[model samples]
Every structure is written in structure tokens, then in C-alpha cells.
Target: MTERLLAFLILCLVAGAPFGAALMWTGNLILDFVFFYPLFMSGLWTFGGLYYWLHWERFWPWSPDAPPPTLKGTPWISILIPCHNEAEHGADTVLSALNQRYPHVEVIAIDDGSTDDTGAMLDRLADTHARLRVIHLARNQGKAMALRMGALAARSEYLVCIDGDAILHRDAAVYLAAPLVDHPRVGAVTGNPRVRTRSTLIGRVQVGEFSSIVGLIKRTQRVYGQVFTVSGVVAAFRRGALDRVGYWSLDMVTEDIDISWKLQRDHWSIFFEPRALCWILMPETLRGLWKQRLRWAQGGAEVFLKNLPGIRAWRHRRLWPMALEYCVSTIWAFALALSMALWTTGLFVALPGHIQVETLMPPAFTGMALAAACLLQFCISVFIDHRYEHGLFRALYWVIWYPLAYWLIGLLTTLYGFPRVMLRRHRARARWNSPDRGIKAPTS
Candidate 1:
């Protein structure tokens, strides 16, 4: 509670900076759009988001679905793990799922035609655990198909899906299943994902990204009764929801986004459970991270393109908000990138072309305001997720790098991905190599 107040205080200070700058009033639209607008939206969204979650129970005290206490004894939950060339990492995930605190839990591990040792690892784990079911596809299929196969093999009504690279918290399954049994129309529960790879700067920064930006936005959207997409790392679903949505899409680049839209279209509500934690590995190199994000951005675009026309329909009104959010975010990314590009090229032309440094950078006042806003957002986010801290505070000095670097990266990804999806004539292929798992040291 004290931390929440501190976050609020920081936001207030950040807000003051912009209004303080407004006293100087240059009347520059570009300056306002590039700097002030982002800062303003950041504070508005962050504060509003925090307010909803912090007092979620009080203001909107009653959820349409009942509380977990009303539910009966232990229910069966199948942990469906889809893998492809994940190797030993797949086994680690299976072990984590089987170790859940929940009673009557089973694991359905699918080896999606991996050329590597992932299949063998699943077999080895299944050999010792009777409840762990292993399904090996003869051919390589997409994640959507692998999940579909695993879902078919699963006997339980409730399903928990985690990436093959993830390690579930001991109580994750138990907490994730609560919404399903407690609520009437709850179809899916998105879990909190923590980064396990902290060996590099990129990895460490992503920890802040997930907790601060991704997690905060999720909580905010959940309060608004809609979410852009569920994190693919760890999510829980009622088997009935999957059935209603016709399962996952084999052609969509991102099965998670595609399926999420499909479920909501069917009138099933999704929930975000922060207590349901799953730690997972992430790409440490720029190249690897770029590939991962591009696939995500592109998948989002594909989904948007498919549903663009339907967004205005009364039946699909819920989708209009998400679609608009994506469009606005995309525009923001491009604008940020263009601003950076002009800065870079202007460096060569600055002194020679007689452009002042003030023109090159955001006005001193606006720059300070933007920086404060970002810091405030990060502080609030990191505070909420401090319990999962991994060198989190120590990594604070590096936080400033995010706004400049990630924005451009997001711009490039969106540019590359959106076109790839739009121009492609063929179906999305099922082929994918193993994701970079960072420089992980082997544990005996």
C-alpha cells in the first residue's frame, strides 16, 4: 500500500513536469506529439491502470463470476506443453508443471516433430511419471496444431498451457484454475511471466519490460473488460472455450492472438491473474529478440487485417477498442522511429546546416518531462512486481535506454512484420528453430 502511494507520488511529479513545461508554451505541435503527448498518455494510462487494479475489489466489487471459495473439492487440470526442438528445456517445463501445488494434476507434453532430443527428453520424463502423457507428432506442425493435438489428448475439463521454455511457480496451476471454477463465463486466464534469463543486458531489461509495461497494460485492459492478447508464455483456458472457438488457428503466425480474438468473439471473458507466475527464458541477442517480436507484431497485424471490417459491427464492438489500440500504438512506434531517424541524420547536418541542438533533441523542458514520465511508469511497475525481482533495482541505471532503443526496435518490427503478413500469398509454415535461450550454464 505504501508503495502504491509512492508510485502515485512519482506520477504526480511526472505530471507536474509537463504542465510546468506548458508554462513556457512554445506552441509546437510536433514537439507536443513527439514528447508531451506520449508523456501525458503514459501518466494517464499508468495511473488509471493502477487505480483499477489496486481498488478493483472495492469499486467493481462484484465480478460476474462467483468467488473461488464457493467451488467444490479438487478439480483435474491438464498442463498442456507444446514443444519443438526445445530439447532438455522441454523436460524442465514438464517437471515444473508436474510439481504444481494443485492436486490431481497431469501433464500432456507434445513433441511437435523435433529433430533434436526434445522427444527423447519427454519420453524419459514420462517413463518415471505415470500422469505425464507424451505425444510425438510424426511431422513438424505449428504451435496451434501442437496445442490442438495436446488438447485432444487431455482428459481434463480445465487446461493450463505454458511455453516449453517456462518453469511454472509451485502454486500457479492452483491459482490459475480459480477463475474457471468460480466464474460462469470465464474462458481464459493469462498468467504473469517473469524472465529467467538475466545473463545479459537485453535479458535484464526485458524483466522490467514484462513487469512494468506488459503487466501493467494487461491489468488495465482487464479492468476495461478487454485485452489485446494473452501472453503465450503462460495461460489457462477452459476446454469448453477452446471448443467454442474451434481451437487454435493453424495459419495465423501467432496462435495465441488468433485464439484470443476467437474466444472473445464467442462472448467468453478472459482474466489476468498476476499471482499465476511462470518464469521463462528469453532471447538475449538483438537478432533473436527481433525475430520473436516481428513474429508477434506480424501476427497481431494479420489478426487485425482479418477482423478490420467486423470491428464496427455491434456483435464485434468489443474488438473495436483493441483494434484501435493496435493502430494507435503502431502509429506511435513509427512516429518515434521517424523522430529518431531525423535526429541521426541531422547530426551530420547540425553544425553545417545551422540546426540548433534544441531542434535536434526534444526541448530541455519536454525531454525532462518525458524522462520523468517513463521513470514514474517503470517505478510503479517494478514496485508491483518487486517480489519477483532479479537484480531488478540494480538494473535501474540502464532503464533510460528503453525509450530510445525499444521504440525504434518496435517501429522496425512493425514495419517488417505488417508487410510480411500483408504481401505473403502462402500459408504460414510450421517450421521454426529453437529460440535463443541465452548463455545458460548446464546444471547437473
Candidate 2:
């Protein structure tokens, strides 16, 4: 472990020195990092997003009503919906899974000791619907355990998992399962999740976020031949692959990210299926959004720390890009915190007038360039994703305010989460914490 830490330290210095020197040379270390780093990453992901769209997504038939992919034989699939306190959306979610256009499929709804009517609703649905099965856990096992229970009871080799609040598109199963069925080595296929709650400004901004940021990232990552993580809200897995990886880790805060890394480490391929659309909700308030993002950031940090040692193997070379990018991003988060600290200190202690603090401030030209890059990135993402989501352009107004907000949230979350993960010693069993699911609107 000490050797590994030393090696990681060396790697960071080797990779970060040139950039650090460049920032120091400019005498605007904080401003350059705060402004230029994201701009640089923005350009990278934009290029990748464009390449993915032009070379891949554009050629595919992506009409909302397009037919399911033709397969030699239809395999029986088990759709697992794990719930805690999801009574409000449980029934709708189950029905959406059961309503899939795929012929041979069953729905397994696991009520993970919900304190609400979610379990009863699932039981009622199972009693009436032959295809629906309900599992009642006596205690609140986390989502990973709930899924593990469902997978154990699943009757099919193919498994599709969705959160209890998601409404699966009728043809979603067909798209999600196609890659697993066709490619013998393909182990998992993650679907695209469209934001369903749009009544509030935060909710509406998330709509563009899912498309412009999340969707674009997935597409770009696919182009890179490995994805950082799968969409946990909606994804399909080959039962064999799940078994090979020992299923989801009980201690993993983000099972989806951990499983993605595990599968890839074990030589299993994961695909991103944009056509497999699932309508989901997001946090509609600042407090709720902060809690949600902080958890996500912590989960990501946990996964990174767990996987870095294993990543040294030659066989895991394919995962290098993701690992490197994650490492850099974590460092960037720390850099932002350091910059803020220096700026605060500068305010109290007299510093030379020439030594300007650059936390939130940047030169006009630099700021304009960064803004333009962000706009371009958003435009490209919306253009590529508008086909999958209608009225996407209308959300541009909301999204215009997204980049700055997103950066702040990301910066703060990582700053908090990275240290928490490092200082934390106990690995407790992961538990569920429900977030604000935002107000619901008509599905139509």
C-alpha cells in the first residue's frame, strides 16, 4: 500500500508539474486553473461529443417511435425495480417495465423495507399481474442488496434494472438487451435517462444537464472505448457478468460506477444505448441538489480509491483514460479549494497589488473564451440530443445559467467528499437515502 501511494504521488507530480509550472509562470495560478482547466476539458469533451455524434449517433435511427432492434431470438428478460419509499411512483414504474414491447419479460419489484405504501402497492400489483413479482425485504437493505436479492430470484439470464421512480420507454428493454444478446462479450448496456420533473427552475435546468452534460459525456466516453460509469437509474446487465463480478459491492456508495469498473477490469464490455430512454426525476431545490451531488461525489471518490491499485495491471490498460481523468478532476477540485483559501488569506493580509486573487475573477478575454467554449459545448450536446428529447431548445435559457452553478456544486462536493473518503476508516453497508424527486408532470 505504501509503494502504491508513492507511485501514485510520483504519477501526479509527473502529470501535473508542467501545468503547475505554466500556471506559476503566468503569475495567475488560481485564475488560470479556475478558468482555463475547465475550458480545456470543455474543449476535449466537445471534440469527443462531436466525433461520437458525427461518426456514430447520427447514423442510427433514433426516432421516438422507431422499431426495436431485430434479434435472432427474443430472450426472456427480468426487469428489476428496487424501491424504498417510492409509493407515489412505484405503480407507474412497474407498469412501464411490464408494458415493454419486448415479448418475453418479467418485472421484479423489490420493496426494500419501505415505510410507505410502496411495498403494499407492489404486492397489490403482483397479486393482479401474473408477470409482476414482488419481494418484501423485512429490513432496509441498500439498493445494491435489494438488486442482489432480485437478481438471485430473477428467472432469466438477462436483467434490466431501473429505479422505482423511473418510467421505462416501451421499447427500452429491446434496445438495452440488444447489445448483450448480439455481442457475446458485452456485459452491460446503460440507457439514456431524460428528466421528467420540469415544473421548477432547478428541475428544468436538470433537463438540459442530463442532455447537455450527462448525455454528451456518455456518448464521448463511448467513443473513447470505455465509459466512466453506467446510468444507475436505467441499465441492463447480462446475468453471467453480474455473477462474474460478484454482483454489486455492498459497501459501494455508487454501485453503478463500481460495477462498471469491476466489469471492465474483468474484461467485460459495456455499451451505452441512447435509444433506451427512461424518464426520471432530479432534485428541484438547492439543498436537495447539494445533498444529492455530495453523495455522488463521495461515491465517485470511493470508486476511484478502490480501483486505482488494481488499475496498474497491463490487462487493465483500457481503463487508463478514465482513471487519469478522474485523478486530474480530483486534483482540480483541491486546487479550487486551495485557490479560495489563498484568496481569503490575501484579503486579510496585505499582498502586493500586483498579486491579485483569482478565485471567482478572471480577465475579460479569458472569461469570454471560457463562456464561448461552454456555449459551444452546450449547443453541440443539445443538437445531438434534441432528437431524443423534444422541446430541448426551450431549456437553453435555463441551461445558460448551468455551467457556473455546476462548477460550484462539483467543486464544493469534491472538496468535501475526497477528504471524507480518505479519512473514513469504517466501510459500513451502503444504505439508501431518498432525495427530492421533483414534481411530476404528465408523461405524454
Candidate 3:
């Protein structure tokens, strides 16, 4: 049934393309009305729907007991926290690591010359926690440099890099380490990160977005061992595998993504464990979110461009295919936005008499289809994330507004990111900014 439906959709697209081309050539109003615009929109929505359907199984977190295979000896794990002006949250992040349920773990907090009381706070935390260690840099080195220093100082077999603002679940460390215990080929494990504070509208919307993204897309990527970005929020890596790639590269803004690609190129398996969760705060305002996404998009483009040669060499290969898939997906969103703009303009300039509303039915139906697609996506989001407070109805509302807002934001970021990528501009400077971790400020 799925294959037949897929084939039918393909035929519709293939047949519609030439019809659209012929209508444009002949300047036939009826054919133009019947074919091009509607088909275009349908194609976009269909692609989205198909993608969601294909990965729908990942919408829920796996059962907790589905543990990674065990190892013979206890492996010492080092937790590296790179802090920059995060005095406000550094202590809490360190404390969270110290509170990990894992028995064989070492907590190392590197204060990247923070101007704030971050260094002092870490000093105090280190004194309190026997397993906690602190490293203070003489100057403000970027996160990549700080991570390198910390990783080098690590005496463990596995190193986990976590942001200063991120708080790991009690079992997160153990879950992260489990993969490496048995899968000798697995170089890294990525944890599912959730937005900690969803008080504001912006925060709530982002919560939904993050849930669907990690729950669906990242999990699908995991199936092929092609997970792209092992988020810096909470990810574990084999020290040897990282050392083999010569440690984290400081040139790019997304060191996480860069390292992931390098690891894949080196034939190292990367796993995404949806059950291994960490909670971190997301940008709470549209402006803040824009800046954050701009940085990410720009960083991604930089990685793509810088590694173009290697990507080309590995075309048709695993990571390369995933990379291309991402690129195409990004481009399609922008294209759909552009096409909508064009269609709206065309609607204003009508060519004369006996206009039939029925002639416009296809485009209208296409719009409805797109809306339904969004609705289905929303359903998935709510189903997966409905465990949190107000999750169901809020997810519905977000689904309604998300596509428009997401594409607009994506378009702006893609436009903003391109030039920066071409000019080699670094927004965050490969450094980590400590988020405000003061006990989630009273929302009321």
C-alpha cells in the first residue's frame, strides 16, 4: 500500500511538471491554473508528509532498560564543562555533573577566563565535591581550546563534553557511557536534549520543535550511523577516537558537527540514544532565537564548504548522503517560500474575463493538503511531547504557527548565514556562552 501510494505521488509529480511547462509555454490560462502552482505546493507538502511518516516510529523515546551492552572492567569517564562568563550557572552545571549516578566518573570544569565569578565559583565547587576538578585559563580561550585542554587532562577512557548551562539527567552519564562499553566501533553517543524552561510562548514553541527534531530526524539518522551533530549540550566520545582525529578543531563555530563528520569519515560509528536525555534552556525571545539559529546555520554552511572536497569524495556514501539530504531539505523550504510569494503576486494580476473559481480549486486543495500535513506533524509533536505540562493543546497551537514561523526564520537565517559563511565570519567564536542558570526564574 505504501509503495503504491508513493508511486502514485511520483507519477503525479512527473506528469504535472511537463503539463506545467506546456501551460507556461502556450500561455493557456486554464492549463496554467490547473497544473503548475497546485502541483508545486503538493510536491512540497507531500515530501514533508512522507518524511514524517517514514520516521514516525521514532516519535517516542525508547524504554529505559534497553541498555547498551556492558563491558568487563569499569571504564573511567571524564565529564568536561567549558565555561565562559557563566558564573551564574557554572556551579549548578558542575553540581549536576557531580550528582551523576555513575560510579566511575570525574567532573572537570574549565573556566575559560570568564570575567564573571565563574572561576571562583568553580574553585568553591571543586573544594566541596571530592571528584570535581577545576581548570582556569589565563586568558579567554574559545570553547574548542578549552575542550581540548580539558580532554587532554582527562584520565578516563571516555570524555563527555557538556555545556556549562546544561544539566544532565541523573542517569544520562551512564546511558552515554553504555554505548562505548561494548560497541568498540562506536566513537560517540548523542543524548536527546530538551528545553528546560518552556514558560514563554517562544520557549514553548521551541520545545515542540526540539522534540520533533530529535525524536524523529535524529533517530532516523541514527539508524544509518550517520547522525550529524552530536549536540554539544551532552555527548560522549571515546578519547582515542577523538585523539585519532587530532582533537577538536578550533576553526569552525560548530566543532561538534565538524568532529562528527570527521569521525564518520574515519569510519567511526556514532549513536543517538533518545532515552538518554538532558535538559537545557532555549532562547526565550524571537530575537535571541534568530541569533542562535543564524549562528547554527552559518556554522553548518562553513562546515559544508570547508569539507566540500571530502564530501564529494564520499558522495553516495553514508555521511555524504545525509549531508546532501539536509542541503536539499533546507533548499526546498526556501524554494516553497519563494514560490508562495510568486503565486501571491500572480493572484493580483488576472488576465481577463470569464474567470472560473473552479479553475483555482487545485491550488486551494493544495493549500488544504499542506495544512493537513502540518496538522499531522503537529499530532506527532503532541503525541511525542505531550507528557510535559499543557503539552497536547500547546503542541496543536504551535503546529499551526510553527511552519510559517519556522520557514520565515529559516529563510532569514539561511540568507544571513550564506554571506557569513562566504566571508568566514564567526558569530560565537567557537566559544561557549554560559546560559543564565539561576534556578529557573519564577515565571509568574
Q: Estimate each model's TM-score.
A: 0.84, 0.93, 0.78
Error of 3 at 210 (Å): 1.2
Screening candidate 3 with a backbone cut-off below 3 angstroms (N, C-alpha, C), the clashing residue pairs are none
Each prediction's Cα lDDT score? 0.75, 0.85, 0.68
RMSD of each: 9.6, 2.8, 8.5
Comparing 1 and 3 on TM-score, the stronger one? 1
Model 2 Cα lDDT, one tens digit per residue, 125-234: 88888999899999899999999999999998889999989999999988898899899999999999998888889998888788878887888888888999999999
The prediction achieving the highest TM-score against the true structure is 2
Q: Roughly what TM-score does model 2 have, to 2 decimal places?
A: 0.93
Model 3: per-residue Cα lDDT over 17-63, one tens digit each: 43344335432344343334333433443344345445653464445
- Residue 315, candidate 2: Cα error in Å is 1.6
Candidate 1 overall lDDT versus native:
0.75
Candidates ranked, most accurate by lDDT first:
2, 1, 3
lDDT of 2: 0.85
Can you tell me which runs of candidate 3 are displaced by over 4 Å?
Answer: 1-71, 314-316, 333-362, 381-395, 425-429, 432-444
Q: Identify the runs in model 1 with alpha carbons over 4 angstroms from their true place.
A: 1-28, 57-71, 336-360, 388-391, 441-444
Off by over 4 Å in 2: 1-27, 351-360
